[model samples]
Target: MEPTRLVYEAWKRTEKIIQNTKDAKGNEIVREVEFYDPYDVKHMEKIDSRCFLCGETIQEGIATKHVFSDVFTDWNRSRYPIGTHVCPACSFTILTNPKNRTSLRNFSFVAEEKLHLPNRVEMRQFLVEPPEPPFLIVLAVSQKKHLAFKGTVSYNREIYTVMLEETEVIINRKEFTRLLAIVERFLFAFTKTEVQTGQYNQQRVLKFGIDRWEWFEEQVKPYRGTELLNVVMFVAQKVEREEDVLCFMGLGQKTKTPPQPHLSFMPSIEAETNDVDQADQICGDKLNDSQKQVQSEQIQLELF
Candidate 1:
């Protein structure tokens, strides 16, 4: 097996190094993403030191940014003009230092137009808990609704949720109106079928809620006395589909078990069981057919 694997690796490396690695657009790749800086004197001294965060040190050279194409095309070595440079110290700092890790994670701001909607609106949605430290906090303002919402996303969970700060919207009348108009138009124009079916809807589910403006205060109090006039948005969920089965170890993976048959026993009759607890509460609220249709349409529009 080792011999066969070695032969395959040699053959593959020969082909890749010859055809793809040659004349790679190292510059273009460099242009697309930002690189970490190691030029600082303090960081430079830590060059041979162990990674501050992970504690592992690469022997080849100073640790630098690791870049890879998402689609896995030919390796464009030259594209990364500004390569990541890390010393043992930085590597360790990155993995172990909570403050440093948080700062690094917070730097992942979405570029403008990355979340553009059809009519030139840009979305500022985030995770309830981002998957990286220095959890993400976003403030969004919509011209149509003249609304601003603030929310935080964590960095550790697969599930992403949006949060609306209970803060007030401070935009002038026109912008606020425009923002609301966009939201309402989306609600009215979207069709129910769109929400009920398709991969896109499955990927981005909308979650909405309204509470006293105090909610915003509690959420943002840590950043005390910050301007509240600029934030306004609602919470939503970001969903992803996995192609393969996922395993959760130990915590007892959920498995289906057939229901056990009940054995009949002598009935216990305590004189009608105190009137069968007539006061037990049961929720019966539901949208009627037309209302359901409209709600579905609203979901579709928001999704779009």
Candidate 2:
């Protein structure tokens, strides 16, 4: 079935459960509401309007932002432009549930395939786990405006900037796969630190500590092109060799030479060097005895 039809059917199923429920004293609850039928011939003769979302003919009922404010109020304006009419099917699909609304924003559906509504398990997964790759993460404020909605992915010495527009989602799967792989490698190289929290004044409070993701993000900003892959690989290699990963990634180093620019799109070496001094102060002491021995041996080899 088409995505719209599938969504509409799913909404009907959910609506049936809600409408057919019994209240106290075995009373069948009934709601006074009008449901639209897009295929009905009599309804089709009423108006010749088109849906703003799927561009389908509005056979029966029409929906507007004012009518369905709950659905459209938090919608992305680029995806759902203002002053656009919604067809019955499109309106019902969006009004299915809050989960469906969230899925619509964060996921791209195949045009010919049926769109599946996100279940509770999938919703939980979105919070605790990272998506496989080539996925969309909608970053928007309360007004539903895009915020910093662009990122570059590097793979096999080639860089691809995945422009995340408010209207569409475009991604190069190969580049995204490579980018995620590098991120996994970078994460695996580090030792997992336990976060401690305590109950204070009827709320759970963080005692101390933060994830290394901020450091990763800072180090990665300067190398968005081909050098990004190399930098990640270098850090992974250092970790394997028992060398200090933070120092290699320019986090724990007091003084360092600026990296020479290789690509035309690469940021200025001097600008990238500016943040190193600040990072040096936050260097972690995670190196073990073996790591110290490895560093000493490397120094001796350099001297020889």
Candidate 3:
């Protein structure tokens, strides 16, 4: 990752931390400073995100949220700085222009998912002095709607106040359950398939088993033809990430094996059977060991 300018604090405890740096002449630099890690504080405010339009419970882990600027016509005549938001299907319906086919693509959504997460840019922490309460916390959040661009960050927190760039999202019991379900599904699907068959790490290798495909399809098919189109668009955006994971797991690649001379299976089988019988009659214990080895080899497709 490229270096970016950021002020980071090292947390010693929930209420102790130290901010150890500052910018120098437009160059990112660290200096001697100290504070407490507020994360260890016994009491801290927690937040949760719900669908503003439909009132449906949005899962925090998989829920899509984006950040965008809404124009304000107040004294400042400034844009309501962008902030992170829940990408509700209903909210899309309420905020979008149906007549403008590309309006959704152009507006709303976090311009990019990776950029939307606070922790994506790794900020190094240093200990120049002691530690403060309510120090900076790195958070990752997602909206149901995909960003139009792949790497944009939202500044919506600026809307509420200049102090916070975005409101903190509080996680709750129901949201935790939803996140667990998605993770479980991903794990099961990951383990059920062959790891690298023909070719390796190709996007086209993202084919899923019939059952796994059906599971994902069912959840998404409901909105396949919806006028709101947010869900459909979001799924399309997720396709790239899905492909990346499949490749990372070796599901989209072929395993390599050494080339060896081969014998006909029929002849090989007959010879092995004859050899086993002969060994059994001649050396009982050694023959038993040999048979066990052969059984294991059979189970392993004789890869060795």
Highest TM-score: give the candidate number.
2
Model 2 TM-score on a 0 to 1 scale: 0.33
- Give per-candidate clash totals: 57, 0, 33
Per-candidate TM-score against the hidden true structure: 0.20, 0.33, 0.20
Question: Residue pairs in steric clash, candidate 2?
Answer: none
Tens-digit per-residue lDDT, 1-304, candidate 1? 1111222222233322111111254432111222233333243432344332223443422434331214423223222323344333232212222233222121213211121111111222222112243233333322211111122323322322222232322222222222222223222322323322211242223321122112222222232222221222232111111110011000111222121111112122222322112211110013445433322322221110
Scored by Cα lDDT, where does model 3 land? 0.25
Worst 10 residues of 1 by lDDT: 243-252
lDDT, candidate 2, at 228: 34
Worst ten in a row by lDDT for model 2? 192-201
Candidates' lDDT values, in order? 0.24, 0.33, 0.25
Residue-level lDDT of model 3, residues 147-259, one tens digit each, is 22122122322111111112332212121222222222343334212111112233323555554444433332332332212211221111123432333223111223222
